[model samples]
Target: MNNHVAPRAAGKQVFITGAAGGLGAAMARMFARHGAKVFLTDIDADAVTAVADEINRELSDTVAWAATQDVRDEAAWIERLDQAAKAMGGLSVLVNNAGIGSLGSVEQIELKEWRRVMSINVESILLGCKHALPYLREAQPASIVNISSLAAFKVDPDYAAYNTSKAAVAMLTKSVAMDCTRQKIDVRCNSVHPAFVRTGIVAPFYDALGEEEATRKLTRGIPMRRLGEPDDVAYAVLYLASDESRYVTAAELVVDGGACAI
Candidate 1:
């Protein structure tokens, strides 16, 4: 408990996936900083542990912990979320942030690869929402933040699998949100669409396209003419997670730098 830390998320129990680095880690850090007890899970156990350790080291009291999870595994989702709920007393937020980058279009991609991409990017959302609902409702005023991508709306031929997978997430978020509301569940559901944040996720694109062309392509038609930061997305999640966005659900927050506007 840093004396200066504002407890915007005080008493919140947050479970985050793919939290070893990049956007997931950023969200974990911000949530913990705002006084949420966060369970940072990832397939990379050691890396997630390091992230939790880093956050705990900075805070006066323990606010973040780590777990290993294969988000694509439905059984793993059930077990890991139960363990996280037990550790946190209950869960108030679920950030289904684990995903991967897939290259190649429908014309070139293998069936196996498309399944792999959808399994990670889209299936994980379904599993997390399904498995975490009970605990989230118990914690009332809870939120499920799905980390979709702008590719969901601005499709590229080369990013066929990735775009399609994110599109599924986009629609899934709305479906879950509506279902929760209709059922009188206290949980909120939303998706974030961030364009090409400067995370390592873009490393593959840069390597594939070469630096100059990749940069140009990524920023093309963007009014900001710049990439976004993980914190930019995390801030949006914070607003949605807190009581401020209590009435906001079944929504998609576009964190892209106006790239989608054009």
Candidate 2:
């Protein structure tokens, strides 16, 4: 199935973080198919390169480049952005989507794990915005789509660390948006909060619950009556990254299937 959408990307360049996993890889391919030069990075070296190779193989001139780097490293952000910009010819989009998840009540979660979750979830977005802003400003009329979570808005036991991290992400997007406007950077920043998606984070848990339980019980809580797919979030990213959302910033687009509405 081809996931490309022409006129949506308009051949702009997009740099995506966490480009190896389900949602990240899907977004990379979708943007490439839409005629954008896509550059991606992940801590998983092999996975990042694999996606880049696949995209380059399919879309030769589209320019797909990947790097292995930790999102928490501030210096690495500049290095990767420079590399990606050099490879893709320019930088027009930044998707601050690299994050890790955890499931534990506040008291039960270890200090190390809590810190790690926050570092990956919150620090990554901050660093991505900090390092990518100058380039985005130069590119002019660029967009940034940050990945938050429904946990930021809803109650979920055993997810205190994750929830807190995402809450920070939500506000970070708004803060960046304000900074852009105040500084007249000509860049738009937005955040997306999605409910349970069928990604690695929840797949194993669903499997342990069996198909019937997974679908009938876990997903029954979702107003949409189903778990969100990576593509569901990818499309949201595409919209925010495109000129279609040019005037839209400092906004949070909850792609949680109305889970937060209830």
Candidate 3:
């Protein structure tokens, strides 16, 4: 089998959220490397700017830009996306990768924490789709990839808020896809469900249990017996964002290590 990955996203203009580090940063780099211009955003102004600078420096060109954004804020979404579309000349891909995880069983979790998780993980996607649709529709053949999680399907009792929010995202993706298709729009929407990727989101697991033990514990249920790399999920996002998946929408692309199978 040939292992070469083609530059499938050439000429695509991508907007990624939570792009300071981890999967968001990885996706931004992958898109830039594969010939797409990426506009990255995160709440951390300094870190996101640094990430954009690092990518430009590495590529020796300005294929990437960064801005500070709070995904839960509708006004911020409108402003940031407008700036990004202007910077990139157009926006063809919007990756809703910004999200937060909440730990605690339903009974233990407070209302504020639940709302926080929902606002970031679920409502943000709604806002992104609502606001980005105009730009995406103008760019036709555009795509929106929402970063959900395996927990959406395979739930963990302690992560009640996170599980509920991601599940909502999966359904919301389908709703958006249906709306676009019903209107004969070329914009596509999809959700990615990744299992235990090596990003800051999972850093707590390593901190709670040292890396060695954490890896073993986390991998015990995974058929591949390993944690996923950032690129593993990034590649999935790349496919969904690129024209390669022009016909794929309202789909959940699972990047799990066969954990969801059983």
Where does model 2 exceed 4 Å of error? Answer: 1-6
Best by lDDT: 3
TM-score of 1: 0.94
TM-score of each: 0.94, 0.95, 0.96
Residue range 1-262, candidate 2, lDDT tens digits? 3555456886688999999988899999889877788998999999999998999898766478888989999999999999988887789999998998898997899999999998999988999999999889989889999999888988677899998999999999999999999998779999999988888877776779887787777666678888889999999999999988889999999998788778
Query: Model 3: what TM-score?
Result: 0.96
Which wins on TM-score, candidate 2 or candidate 3?
Answer: 3
- Would you list the C-alpha lDDT of every candidate in the order shown? 0.90, 0.89, 0.94
* Colliding residue pairs in candidate 2: none
For TM-score, the strongest prediction is 3
Residue 124 in model 2: lDDT: 85
RMSD, each candidate, Å?
2.1, 2.1, 2.0
